[model samples]
Target: MDDPDSNAAQLASPSYRLPALDQDFLLGDSMRGVRFQLEFAKAEEVLRAWGIRTTLVVFGSARVREDGPGRHADWYAEARRFGKLASLRGGAMRDVGQVRDNVIATGGGPGIMEAANRGAADVGAPSIGFNITLPHEQEPNGWSTPGLTFRFHYFAMRKMHLAMRANGLVVFPGGFGTFDELFELLTLRQTDKAPPIPVVLVDETYWRTVIDFDAMVSHGLVSPSDLSLFRFADTAESAWQSLIDCCLKPHPPSDYVPVP
Candidate 1:
């Protein structure tokens, strides 16, 4: 019902958009490669701006609660304590100008992830939560620092962010997702794609019952040296200490900077 000239004018207006405003175009397969770069850069830019030089990834079952269940209760407590200890000792609680190292990072959901991020919060330090969309609905734990929390649609991109700045990886009792991350690091270490950072599994009892790394070695399926790729810790203190022993030197001077 409009004149041809007015119709043409409306079409040329700013309100008339291109494919840039089309969600279908952006989410389509043809734009996947662009999405990948955006995913990588988005997290990287924020992390860099925040001065996150190193990261310590904490992985575990989302089902574990702070108290309700038995072993779950114990693990939740231990993970929380470990988060505090790691943040205190690893430099997350240092003054703004001080060197920041091993900033606590987690899957950014409840369970052990919340415990770890909560520990860092206890010390009034910033922590990171790398969460992914899931069928069952996983949300970022509230304990993680506000600006540092991130959500990703792609699992590969999510894992990339986890490992990229990782200085240590600590795994607690968990199932498939935990195992996926745990073994991915192991494989990267095994294949020499990753540097030998400390990889500690919480609770010797749980880990031993779950998998037989020794059996794998005995069967010649894996070399005996492969077993050294990870070790076990029964408490938070021991776990954080092992990371210091395995990869980090004693807390450096506040002003210390590595000479390149």
Candidate 2:
């Protein structure tokens, strides 16, 4: 029977047992879904390329306006200070010598993120920013250097990049995202999945009221030594000095030659 049209119609219909990917039976917007999936893959590749090293991750709020008060302002201001210092030292060392490669990195958005990026740029030092695409928030701050700013679709991958490369983590006062990052890093170290990288909780006033490390100890959820995983700092200078002491010791196990 000459019924080719009818046969084609049956093959395309849902009732007919067909292949897995049916353009008709797809969920949500197909273009949007595929875009996100591609983005996720690209992000993983970008993060993996950075490799393991002594990197610093600065987690903070993206909504922090250039001006604010209390914790928000303090976090951004301190980030700026420390970022610039790190950049300067990095530049100086890389120019004629190779002391270390502790590049300052951030979430690649505004607020404290901006402060950190700004600081790095201020000293003309290359930095990294793991930018996430969001409809309402999370745009790469102006301070993020060209070629160093990257966007990620998966929060987990972005966070993984941060932890994998970090020799230390400096967390500024922030909301849910900040707390999530802080806990994850602490968990990794406590669980022995990751090395004991120095975690500095900036702004003691804000941090103390927000989360109780003692409470974790009180409930027997964590050991007393877990408290040693982090320390409190109030200023950029203090925090940078802490980093110098902790991560920037002479590499290669060789004696450090002081600058004459």
Candidate 3:
């Protein structure tokens, strides 16, 4: 017989044990959300090696193939190229687009995330990936720094980490999850919860169709000036240049301090 008090305690303080890679913990049809939470905690340990500060998040699609005239490849190549340029400034200085003090960050899976991480690795610069644990295991990209690949169970915590470490955000074409992330950041900025950092969206064709900024203005949904929140760039050169221009400008001292 199970004690009611013991059951209550278990519910209040959920505890989980890590299973071996081959083990199948899922039983029946029910999904245990807490499994992800535990996995996230386990992955956080990996990020401990790279303190979560001064990071740039490069987000895009994971399903994107490596070749075949895809914008995905273009996005990755550009990120890598810019990362190498940034790394030349040395690890001690800030890349503010050229300073190189911050690590390039991404989701640990493939596609755009892989591109960003690959870019950093190509330049021999450190990169960080905050990967999610799903029912289907998603492996870290080949370009990820050996020790820097991190896995996470909690989506909220992962987002928090991204918000905490990011000095800039570069977004590329992706799916639903990507939209969620982009909007979350936009909301945070609008609410004054986050400082205004450079937000660059790659691929003007897709973005223009997806986001009707002019319509929003026409409907009085948002102020026209609010459209300045993001800078759209079609090519890698334009994206890198936008970051350089923004970073080279003198940032207000208050904005430079890390949010506690």
Candidate 4:
């Protein structure tokens, strides 16, 4: 007869656990690559299931609130307006065939992200929020479609998801995080790694004050043509129009039935 203690010990052994059910094993350093792949696949699958074919990515400061000081109110209001305008005009309102294009996507936090998501909600359109885990926990804005909101621990994976299906990019005033996202996409465009998509920066005065693209050109830091990668707009309507001018083709009306 087998010893009961020995049998119990064997059953409780970590090695004997199923890999998929083993949290310690899954979260270990050796599984980092697997975690990255999981992050990519999970978001990809949900997005595909939702018929999100492409997105108009919005980047901005999470610090800007509608009631905040100075230009914050205007910026917030405009961002919200842009979200609604884009959704109404960009085929995100179409439920036919479950193929949504140019849906608004943001970082899934408060401030500008919340405003954009709220705008889409106001028009009864679904939007996406890609939240990330930070030292200070970031709560997802309530406006993003619950199923479409996601959280990622890996910045690279999050950035990958942001860039992969972008039809266009609209950047509002922001700080370091926003700049990181903006420049990454611009670099991709400049190097031909990403397809030429419309890039618009809202608030010409603010952008010019913050960065001297023309000076970069004169100093030979960047070629004169590189400055053409993005254009500036003072309002949400003009920003959208700039995208249209840059040949952002809105999805055409379709008669196909939604997938059940």
Going through the candidates in the order shown, the clash numbers are 0, 0, 8, 0
Model 2 stretches astray by more than 4 angstroms: 1-53, 90-100, 250-260
What TM-score goes with each of the models? Answer: 0.91, 0.74, 0.72, 0.95
Compose the digit string of candidate 3's lDDT tens values, residues 75-95. 666666655544333241233
User: For candidate 1, lDDT tens digit of each residue in 1-260?
Assistant: 77766678777765575877767778889999988898999999888878888889999999999975779999999999888777767767656655567899999999999999998898777899999989989889999999999999899999989998889999999999999999999999999999888899999999999998889988899899998888899999889788877966445436544312
Which portions of model 3 show Cα errors greater than 4 Å? 1-52, 89-100, 248-260
Residue 133 of model 3, lDDT score: 89
Off by over 4 Å in 1: 8-19, 97-99, 250-260
lDDT of 4 by residue, 1-260 (tens): 87866778777999999999999999999999999999999999999988999999999999999999999999999899888888878879877467899999999999888888888888888999999999999999999999999999999999999999999999999999999999999999999999999999999999999998999999999999999999999888898899999999876345423212
Candidate 4 deviates by what RMSD?
A: 3.8
Q: Looking at model 4, how many pairs of residues clash?
A: 0
Better of 2 and 4 by lDDT: 4
Best by TM-score: 4
Question: In candidate 1, which residue pairs clash?
Answer: none
Alpha carbon lDDT of each predicted model? 0.87, 0.72, 0.69, 0.91
**In candidate 3, which residue pairs clash?**
36-153, 40-152, 40-153, 80-119, 94-99, 95-98, 95-99, 95-100
Q: Which ten residues in a row have the lowest lDDT in candidate 4?
A: 251-260
